[model samples]
Target: MGIPRTPVRGVAALAALAALSLTVTACASEKATGGGGEASAPSAVGGDGVKTGPGVTADKITIGLMTDLTGPYASFGKSLTQAQQLYFEQANAAGGVCGRQLEALVRDHGYDAQKAVAAYTEIAPKVVALAHVVGSPMVNALKQRIETDQMLTLPQAWATGLLGSRAIQVTGTTYDIDMINGVDFLTREKGLKSGDRIGHLYFEGDYGESALNGSKYASEKLGLTLVEQKIKATDQDMSAQVAAFKAEGVKAVLVSVGPRQTASLVGVSLAKGMDVPFVGSNSAYSPQLLPTPAGPALLKDFYYMTAGTPISSELPALKKLAADYTAKYPDTAIDSGVPAGYSAAAIVVDALKKACEGKDLTRAAVVAAHRGQSAWGEEFGTIMDFTTFDRPASLLSYVAKPDKAALGGAVVFEEATTSDLAREYRVPVG
Candidate 1:
């Protein structure tokens, strides 16, 4: 929907699936394991209506991922795919899911909607489930298809409607919920009193539109005024749009655009002397976007929201995971999207672990085993919880700002936020 930023870009280059039936009713039929535990790997049944991956075997479990690796969002796809790969490598190093190595069956869609459909079609019948499918539209394209096949599609992008379906699970806060949280926190904690105006600049797409609507809904709930601007994803210049917002004299700006466009907006905003603090959706926060002169000027007063726990948080377990990740693949960015990818990938590992718990790996048994599994407290944060019932997750999010410690010259944490209205600010750390 929006331009692909680093996180989105990485996912684009790295990850696929086809149309699955939306029918989510659980049914059971007796099916035998292929052989003794090691030889009896999971197999696809006949010419399938949808795609499926080969399942649990004595040695490895094949989990498929469809991402935007080559087309519009290649950078995002690449980063996300690397993240998943690293996580799996780490998990594999630790003996993998349920004593079986987790092997990712990744396919790239180049962020094309049709390609995403085709990718899903090819991978559906081969893997146990789809792990960390990126993009709002790409995932949207295959939602019903995944459902019909009864394959759980753990998503990295936030599209709230997917929450109501059985086949899709999210790793972080929904767009609406994250927007409301940011809006509420800004007002309640940051002291943005009534009468203050906020401006929104977003590209026109499902990603941007969802963000716009979410911001609108939050603005109404928070009793704030919102000025809107729409930009084409292909538009590189934002001087005119910045001029309009500057003319309005709003106190803050909320941006939802890809890295390239976001850079253009920041450049235009700074050139125009519109020093109002900016708030952005997940799209704007990326290490690749920063590191230029434009980064400091535009991002200095910028605040963004995210659906995952920061690597900087003082959680011992998560810290250990991060440390291990760093020790192995010293080059991964491990920023916002990477953690989201890891968390989503981890859940698939959980599912596989459950599927292979007591019996040999078989399609029928793996599907049956995962029927009512709940990941309510795996410790990924409030955004990712699974239950056999009841919305599974709290859908919480955190407010973060840029810092020096984050990878690629971008760091984020709650301790970095500031409110220009109240004159309250957190200490800035390099």
Candidate 2:
């Protein structure tokens, strides 16, 4: 998953039933009670006058976050998790949804499919909804279970294959959409032209494949040749891939892998003097990489696309978020994940608030509330329309380049905008 930039602004796996041991982290706000020392009465309740369901109680609501920590994407996950915790803390301070304190049940899957399943199975019965689930493979592994429970889940993934599921809401543009816009940027701004060969280095699963689909569509639409190179999440060395692209004489490269792989690819390519421009999906970059050996290489020719505003933006919401987060986590480094996580939690809170209005906090009611949202706006990014599940909430993407001195280590070069080809391209549904 990637962070947001507007003009900035901003998968699946199978189930393995192996014995899994995991730690469940809890982040909750101080409990609040009525003036007379009685637990606050719920603003509304179900028809039976008792509104209760998994993770929802008279005085508290629990939401689950399944993310990657101590894994390849740990940097992204840790920052995202912290931002969500911050949001929940603020919400609780302001009197949580339906007059109940909000609690976040966080479990780290370490980006492993089996661990993700185990974590979900353990937390599913204790949460009203999922605020965030990271990794396309992890989400894909739990897709059927999520649907069966009718749980409203916000995945930190953008693969198009994850679409069409009412229960799984992808918060922003899909990976394909980002790539479509990315390809356009290369042609229109980076000096690539029609008939030029474009190489794509992507992971093998839904994340990469879905992004590849977009590049394929863009190439076909604009008369470019796409050279494909598929890699695994575990693959780090990109020397061979760079050699191949060099041989193919590709003018540009699109990446759909994680930050580590991105570093390797760019660093190796630069070392070999393969100075072509590189664009990546949101998942392909991390602020943590700015200090690494590949930092210079990435800064020179690497760009990424996302659906949210960058943390360095002058947007008021983003500024406030940065200030609050810095105060809360004095020792932590701010990154794109801060906005990404906060935006996601904001969406979940919106749904919960809507559900409260109807006097229902049941899992099904929460889902309904989320589906009712249309043209929902967030200060950190573009407007999102969630009434439908077949396409992205927004199509606009921000093009950004890594900046060593910037907050989140990135600065947007192209504000949020949609390419004509992207607008015309049909989004594939599962």
Candidate 2 local lDDT, 284-321, one digit each (tens): 88766666677788889999998878889889999899
Model 2 residue 405 distance off true place after TM-score fit, in angstroms: 0.9
lDDT of 1 by residue, 153-250 (tens): 77666645455666676555555555556666667656676778888888777667767766787677557889999988677667888888888888
Model 1, CA-based lDDT: 0.60
Q: Which one is best on TM-score?
A: 2
Tell me how many clashing residue pairs each candidate has. 43, 21
TM-score per candidate, in order? 0.78, 0.89
Report how far off residue 227 is in candidate 2 (Å).
1.0
